[model samples]
Target: MVGVETSQHVQLSYEPAGVGDRVLAYLLDGFFMGVYFFVVFWIWGYWYSLGSDPADLSLSWVFYVVIVLPLMLYHLVSEVLWKGYSPGKKIVGIRVVKVDGSRADLSGYLIRWLFRLVEISMTSGVIAFVAVIMNGKGQRLGDMVGKTCVIKERKKAKLEDTLFKDVSEGYEPVFPQVTELNDKDIRVIQDVLDARSHYEYDTWFKMLKRTRQKLEARLGVQDHGMRTDVFLETIIKDYNAIHGSVK
Candidate 1:
């Protein structure tokens, strides 16, 4: 629900994950941890029961190192390895990012993980729920301290703000014939592209067929083995690359 602007302040590029998504992801993570702790405890308890043996008696510290340490570090290590995605977050299609819409660094994840001990483990997520609901940006105590927020990627993004679509860097323009499209023609193309999400597959395919035919006739471009959607986006990028701004 929170908006982060896209390229050149054109429109909101990313949507913040809703509280429901956050809670579900949190529960999934907690469940995973619960399973993990149970397994580790069962194995460790069996090992510790062997403490009557002198060989096992000397390694009492092993329990703390193997079980407790990893339990404590689970979230930190998972987020670090997965680049802001714990197993649960990945399944929920959400990720943690810096507030400015960039990926968080190791230090950022560490800060958030540190706060997890208090908000989640100690108070049982009461604090985290309150903080996330009170704040409009979907930030928990950890996120606020780490300058990070969770965002969901499951929903389709709205690209209606401006005609200037953000092209990935180092994109090579394939169809030079895209230059034949005037502003109005390009606008029609953009309209078709944006409208695809609103229609079912059959209707959208028909629209794509008509648009592609029109573009091919006007610009004399072929499919080049690209899908209908791919061809359309390429020309839009080509238009951007060849012609700088929308205006």
Candidate 2:
């Protein structure tokens, strides 16, 4: 298990898929790719056989353009559309995530796909396996360049884990400056609140202190005899009341 520290300083435990699991996923993908290529190439061959001279076929380039190009782009396209989960990764119950616990974006997916050739294809996955084991982050060369890691998707904690309290409709917010933070910021805070059990009390203390300080500085308000935990809890409720849930 690798401990990933989210942007809010929350420690989330991730089970990095081992080299064997990765290899299995790759093989599954390869099987699909192979079957696709076989069927495509057979059709192409039949098309070619109809022409006496290969050069006479005006659509010969279609084979490369339609089949080869898509084959090469399979990983990139799948990951981007599926939000870091290719069919194989999804089946393996693993997905790519940013180190900071944010969703992996298009650029990150592209980086990983670009390096897939050398990491998995060229070296026959030896390099990727070795790198993943050594790095302990379930990362191949692509993941390193992309600044992402593959982790088993487990049951994530719900909003209830944050222990949000109910607020009356007429209740006034403590900090209007909570607007300075966005949905992502609130999510980070929620993740921090949810993941308290994963860290020591001292670590949680420092995290709460740091979060409180940042919020205070941003709001231009000094502490007004509010405990750190209470302050944070109120901030969450205020943000939710002011903006609904984080989108």
Candidate 3:
């Protein structure tokens, strides 16, 4: 799990996905691959048992190469272009990211795939599955080696309700003098207000406190006795009202 604390009214947090999800994903991938391999093996067996000349066995390697290359190409192309997610993973709503909270790059993807050989070679991936099950962060051998973790996609929050609630009820702004907020501060505020209803009360309160501190420091405004939540509600309402009128 990684905790991100913003110095504004935004509480963004995420947990690494558990082993059950990973196992299900693996089984899905395996099912697809199994069907593919069955067709390939059937063709190979038919070709080899034809009682052809021994020299024709040299051409059997060609069939093996043909069978393996497409699977490899599929992995290579999808991971590089889609940021560590294949079509299946995308459908499952899981994505891989680096430990530093960035998208997984080409190198990370390659490393993870390479390490997957070790995972596959150990008791038909039983060892790797167990490792993910036991690990605190739900990391398999490949994930540990690649320094990546799977995370669920977050739902986008609705901003209109949180930002304009009290304003629609005729609430007045208390901090009238604070101005010239930066883009980052504004974004943090937008995120916080948007997701206000999704988070716990304590989390919301902490975000409000941080936003108040940052706003006061940046604008050099003296703090009024108003509650942080009330101040935020008032400011967002004022902004929306002013901006809405201009449009």
Candidate 4:
């Protein structure tokens, strides 16, 4: 388990996939891509053989443009559309995300895709393996440039970790303003809540207070006559109830 510290100073745990896993995924991706190109090339070859002059085969520009271009673009397109999982990464149960625990944006994804030519393709992955080993974060050159790391996908232990709560009937959300917070904000709130009982009183209070202040600022609410812990819990319950209904 590696700790990825976010910009907000919250540390999240994720298991970084090993070099072996990455290599296996790469081989799988290569096999699939190879099969695709082989079929396309075979079709084109047969068509040209039947009618076109044999001399035309020397140009072969069509194959490069049609097959190679899309192959090179594959990583860029896949990561962008699938939110950081190429077909290989998806198969291996790994995904790329920003170090801050937020989603990787388009430019970040593009940077990783571009660096793949040097780190993986051009070097046959020697450079990638060395970098991943040294970085301790499962980062290839692409990941470094993109500010992202690949993490293994696994089932979380606690229900609260995923932020699903059971709100009772007749629940009136004290603050509809809770909607102003996004998933990352709520995740940090939940993390604080879940960790509070484990820490000393003063330590817990400090974290709780910070969380409360942040939420209060975002929601523009204050001094609701509820205990600090209760206020935070209520906000979470209210958010789940409101968002659940919308879903």
**Candidates' TM-scores?**
0.61, 0.65, 0.70, 0.66
Which sequence of candidate numbers ranks them by lDDT, best first? Answer: 4, 2, 1, 3
lDDT of each: 0.76, 0.77, 0.65, 0.79
Q: How many residue pairs clash in each candidate?
A: 0, 0, 0, 0
Off by over 4 Å in 2: 1-21, 38-63, 80-83, 91-93, 97-115, 145-148, 151-185, 220-223, 238-247
Better of 2 and 3 by TM-score: 3
The parts of candidate 1 lying over 4 Å away from their true place are: 1-11, 45-60, 155-247
Local accuracy of candidate 2 as per-residue lDDT tens digits, 45-95: 797888755665446577678788889998889888988787888888888
lDDT (10s digit) by residue, model 1, range 1-247: 4444332222223568888888899889889988988997777668768665646644768767866788798888988889889888999999988887778899899999999889988999899889988987879989998999888774544543435676666777899887777666665666666655556778767777777776777777664788887888778878888777433
Q: What is the lDDT of residue 14 in candidate 3?
A: 60
Highest-lDDT candidate:
4
Stretches off by above 4 angstroms in model 3 are 4-11, 34-65, 73-76, 157-187, 190-207, 245-247
For model 2, name the residue pairs that clash.
none
Clashing pairs in 1: none
What is candidate 4's CA lDDT for residue 153?
A: 77
Question: How much is 72 displaced in model 3, in angstroms?
Answer: 3.7
Candidate 4 Cα RMSD after full superposition onto the native fold (Å): 5.2
lDDT by residue for model 3 (104-195), tens: 77777777777776675446778777887787665677778888767766655455443333344454445554346543555567667555
lDDT of 4 by residue, 1-247 (tens): 4455554565446678888888888888888889889998898789887898767665668657779888999888988899978899899888788865567899889898889999988999899999999998889888888898887876456654457677777888879998887767766777777765456778778777777876787788977888888888888888887877321
